[model samples]
Structures are given as structure tokens and as C-alpha cells.
Target: MQSWLDMLREARAQGRRFARVRVVTLPLNDYSRFGVWCSQFTNGAGEDIRYLERGKAAALALPDHDYWLFDSRKLVRMHFDDRDAFLGGEVIEDAAEIVKHNYWRDAAWHHAIRRDDLATEQHLGRV
Candidate 1:
């Protein structure tokens, strides 16, 4: 955890920006709650983390998968196993796909709440 925070801090110190839009369910599960706890450190390190409730995102027809978009051009779409374990990601640079991902990012960002605000509003705490 310290190492991870160090990396984020270093990246921010070097002028690299970070953003994440997490789709979460109401009454968050243990993992989701833990992620909220972790976000505190990362957010302080300059990561612009936000949360979009699953139902709200579904209403907007947002894609279900998580991804990392870089420079509004390159995207690293994450893949997960049935048990929700990380299964690595596929890098995509196709113009059309990048546009699609950026579209979702824009929509999500427009509606999502910042992590701390969501945590407070939802009364989130360690599970």
C-alpha cells in the first residue's frame, strides 16, 4: 500500500494526472468499501476519483467494463474473471473505440460524485 501511494505521489509530482470513474452498487460490498478507504490516499495524491452508482450509470447506458484512458487517445480496457478477479487489460488505439470510451468517460464524469462526497452521503465506513 505504501508503495502504491508512493507511485501515485511520484506520478502527481511529475505532472501526471489520474482519474477514475467507479461504478458502484448501493450498500457497497466489502471490496467496494475497502476501495473507498484506499481512495483517500490516492485522491490526496492527485487522483480525481469519482463514483457513479450502477443503477444511475445503467440508466445512461454506460459500458460495464472498467478501463484506463490515457491522453484521450489510448485506452487500456480491463478484463475480469467470473469471480471478479483481475485478468489484465487490452490496449486499444482505434479511433472509433477511443471515441466511444471517451464518450463514456465524459458522461460518467458529468454525473459522478467525488469519492469523499459519496462516502459521506452514503455513510460509508470500513466493512
Candidate 2:
């Protein structure tokens, strides 16, 4: 976690932006709550994290899985098991695929609420 925070800080120093939209469920499972707690540290380190309730995200028809879009150039599709354990990631450099991920990123970012704002509004940080 320290390494991740350091990376985020370094990226910010280099004027690079790091952002993510976390889709969370209504009931807030233990894992989701833990993620919310962890986001505070990451957010402080310069990552722009946002939260979107599952229902709202469903309307956007975002991918059922997770991914990382870097600089609107490369896409890393994340794979997980049925139990939600991380398996691995597939790096995709195809222009068309990257473009699609970029569009998803934009749509999610537009509808998601900033981490701090959502925490305050939903009293999530208290969890």
C-alpha cells in the first residue's frame, strides 16, 4: 500500500492524473467498506477516486468487469474469480479496445461522485 501511495504521489509530482470510479453495492459488503476506508489514503496521495452506486452504474451499461485505462492508450482488463479473487490482467494495446475503455471511463467519471463527497453524503467514512 505504501508503494501504491508513493506511486500516486510521484505521478502527481509529474503532473500525471490518476483517477478511478469505484462501483459499490447498496448494502456495502465488508470488502466494499474496506475499500472505502482505503480510498481515503489513496485520495490523499493524489488519486482522484469516485464512487458510483451499483444501480446507477447499471444504467450506464459499463463492463461487468474491471479495467485500467492508461493515458487513453493502453487497456488492462482485470479478471477475477467467482469469489472475487484477483486472477490476473490482460494487457490490450488494440486501438479500438482502448478507445472503448476510454469512453467507459468518461461516462463513469461523469456520473460518479467524488470520494470525499460521497463519503460525507452517505456517511461511508464512518463505517
Candidate 3:
């Protein structure tokens, strides 16, 4: 975890922005709670983390899976199993796919609430 935080810090130092919009359900599951805990450290390290309720996210009709968009160009789509266990990621370099991912990122980022604000709103103190 320290290494990840260091990487975020280094990226910020290099003037690179790292951000994520996590779509979560009303009653957060164990995994989602864990992610919220981790976000505290990541946000402190300069990564911008936001939260969007699942119902709100549904209106946007974003992808069912998670992805990482690099520089609004390259994309790494994450895959999961039936039980939601991690599988792997597939890198996509197709321009059209990249554009779609960028659009989703922008839309989610625009509607999501910042980590701190969400924590306060949800009464999730330190967890």
C-alpha cells in the first residue's frame, strides 16, 4: 500500500493527475468499504477519488465493468468472474473504444462526490 501511495505521490509531483470514480451501492459491501478505507490514503497521496451512488450511475449507463483510461488514449478493461473475483484486464488501443472510456470518465467525474465529502455525507468516519 505504501508503494501505491508513493506512486500516486510521484505522479502528482510529475504533474500527472490520477483520479477515480467509484460506483457504490447504498449499503456498501465489504469490498466497497475496504476501497473507501484505501481511498483515504490514496487521496492523501494526491490521487483524486470520488464516489457515485449506483442508482445515480445507472442513469449514465456506463460500462458494467471497471476500466483504466490512460491519457484518454489507452484503456485497460477489467474483467471479473461470477462471484466478482478478479480475472484480468485487456488492453484496448482502438481509438473509438478509448473515446468512449474517456467520455464515461468525464461523465462520472462530473457527477461523483469527492471522497471527503461522501464520507461526511454517508457518516463513514475513518471507514
Candidate 4:
């Protein structure tokens, strides 16, 4: 747990100095399996993530604020404490790649659209 906190502190420092902070939103349910959350952010070489684990949860940020949640339906997304900060971040215009999706069929995890950042909680359909 201490190491996880350290990584987050480092990520925050990086966020401030290099803008590595990526904020996203996801639908979360307490009853759902936690492994789904762990696999998302854990893609990077780190201990907080489970890498390929299928049904676990990972605390992306400290204080259990935001998370990467996965549902039994194979839907996964990152969650941010503040939707405004996330949607309006520089990742939209700067990141080399970006992905976005809605609970829709045609989209199916649409990727390569930097403009996807514009879709915030306000734009999201009813949960």
C-alpha cells in the first residue's frame, strides 16, 4: 500500500511538472467485481495494477477518489473526481492517441479522436 501511494505521489508530481495526469470518467458500482478496475491503469509497469487480472479494482488516485472500473459486460472506463477537470484537460489536444466511447453500438470503444475529451458527465446520457 505504501508503494502504491508513492506511485501516486510521483504521478502527481509528474502531472504538475510534465502534465502526465489523465483524468477520465467511468460508471462505478460497489457491487461489481474489483479486478476490472485494476487492469486498466495497471497497463503501465507498476504494482498497483494487476496487469491482466479480470475482476479486480484499482485505486488510480489516493483517498480512493477516482478509479478504473469494469463491469461484467466488458465495459471499462476511467473515473475522475471532477468531470470538468478531466474533460477540459490538455490530453484532448496533446496526447498522441485518445479513445472514447458511449453505451452505444456504432462507437464500440472509438479510438484516435482527441476531441473525445469534450464528452463530459454533462454530455453523457443518463446512467
Candidate 5:
């Protein structure tokens, strides 16, 4: 068992500031466009990507349905296999679970999202 957020907090405590973090919705291509009318971003999601939407304090709390998290310190690089677990809300405490589960597939234009900084672009929409 691991917590991506906890690992990040600990790293921060040791004077490490996260430069960037990323949350890719992953391609839900299995479903047809009409199959999904619209999907809500995890939390703090501006548009296409969701960052560390909350501060250390708020993240520790996880708030409501926006509890999904990723830890840059713990995990890096996005791949294709990491789709289900990330969106499924499993191991959400540690966003790095994406890496653990190999859920990201590095496609073109992928980026990393961090709480302090965000990749600006409004992304909440229907397929």
C-alpha cells in the first residue's frame, strides 16, 4: 500500500518542490462517442488535464469525489496501460498508481501537471 500524495508531502517536507504533475484522462476509445455523453474531470481540472488540483492540506483531506491524486516524486512518465486504474479511482491516494499500473500511453502533446503550475486549456467536454 502507498499514497502518492503522502510521498509528495514527505518530499516537499524535505525541501522538494514538484515541478510538474500530470493526470491524463486516458483514451476511453473502447466506448463510442455517444456511449459517453460527458465526463466530469477528477477535480481541479480546468479542461483537458487535471493537475494537483488541491494544496497539500486540502489534498490530505481529498474532499468529495475529487480524491484521485498522483505523485510525481513516486511516479513519472505516462504510458498506455495505465488507463483503467487511474480513472477507476483505485489507488487514487498515490497518483503514481498510474505508473504502478502502467496506465499512460505517451501520445503526442502529452504534458505533466503540477499543483503550483497548470497546463492552461479548458478541457471538460463531450466526446
Candidate 6:
């Protein structure tokens, strides 16, 4: 986590934009709670992180897949194993697919709550 934060810090220092939106289910699990705890530092390093409840995201018809969209031009769709372990990703260069990912990213970002706010709510047992 510190390694990623270091990279993010450097990227922000270089004027690069960094953001993440995590879709979490209600009754947060241990892993999810840990992530929220770590976000305190990452968010402080200039990474704009947000959270959206799974139910809310489902109502919006968002896919349950995760991917990284680079510069609005490239995408690498993530593939996970049955146990939700990271396997690998397929780099997608198709214009249509890239457009879809960009659109989703924009929509999710628009609706997701900031990490700081979510963390506070979670810590207070209101999430």
C-alpha cells in the first residue's frame, strides 16, 4: 500500500490525475474496512478516491468488473478468479470499448461519494 501511495504521490507531484471508485456491498467486510482505513493516507497523497454502494451501482446498471482506463484512450479489463483473486487483464485498444469505459468512469465518478466522507461515516457506524 505504501508503494502504491508513493507512486501516486509522485504522479500527483508530476501533475497527473489519479482517482479510484470502489463499489462495496453493505455491511462492509474486513477487507473493505481495511481499504477504507488505508485510504486515509492515499487520499492525503492526492489520490481522489470514492465509494459507491453495490446496490446503488447495480441500480445504475454498472458492470461488476474492474478495469484501468488510461488517458481516456486505453483500457485493461481486469479478470479475477472464482475466489476473487487477481489473475490478469486484457489490454483493450478498441475505440468502442474504450469509449464505454470512459463513459462508465465519468458516470461513477459523478455519483460516488468522496473517500473522506465515506470513511467518516463508516467510522461512525453510519455506513
Q: Which structure among the candidates has the greatest lDDT?
A: 1
| lDDT at 64, model 5 | 24
In candidate 2, the residue pairs with backbone N, CA or C atoms under 3 Å apart (3 or more residues apart, or in different chains) clash, namely none
Each model's TM-score?
Answer: 0.91, 0.91, 0.94, 0.19, 0.23, 0.92
Per-prediction backbone clash count:
0, 0, 0, 6, 18, 0
Which prediction has more favorable TM-score, 3 or 5?
3
Q: How big is the positional error of residue 93 in model 2, measured in Å on the Cα after superposition?
A: 2.5
Cα error of candidate 1 at position 22, Å: 0.5
Evaluate model 4: give its TM-score: 0.19
Candidate 3's residue-wise lDDT over 1-127, tens digit each? 8999999999899999988999999888788878888899999999999999998888999777799988878899999999989999999988898998899999999999988887777778875
lDDT of each: 0.90, 0.88, 0.89, 0.28, 0.33, 0.86
Model 1: worst 10 consecutive residues (lDDT sum): 118-127
| Candidate that scores best on TM-score | 3
Residue 92 lDDT in candidate 4: 28
Off by over 4 Å in 2: none
- Cα lDDT tens digits, model 5, 1-127, are 1354456556766875443223333342334222222222212222233243224324344222323224422333222343434433333335455543333322111333432233223332533
Off by over 4 Å in 3: none
Q: How high a TM-score does candidate 6 get?
A: 0.92
37-77 in candidate 4: lDDT tens per residue?
Answer: 33334323232321111121123112222222222122333
For residues 56-115, write the lDDT of model 6, one tens digit per residue: 888888889999988889899999999999999999989998999888888888889987
What ordering of candidates by TM-score runs from best to worst?
3, 6, 2, 1, 5, 4
Clash pairs, model 3 backbone: none
Q: Which regions of candidate 5 are displaced past 4 Å?
A: 21-127
Span of ten consecutive residues with least summed lDDT in model 6: 118-127
Candidate 4 CA-lDDT value: 0.28
- The lDDT of model 5 is 0.33
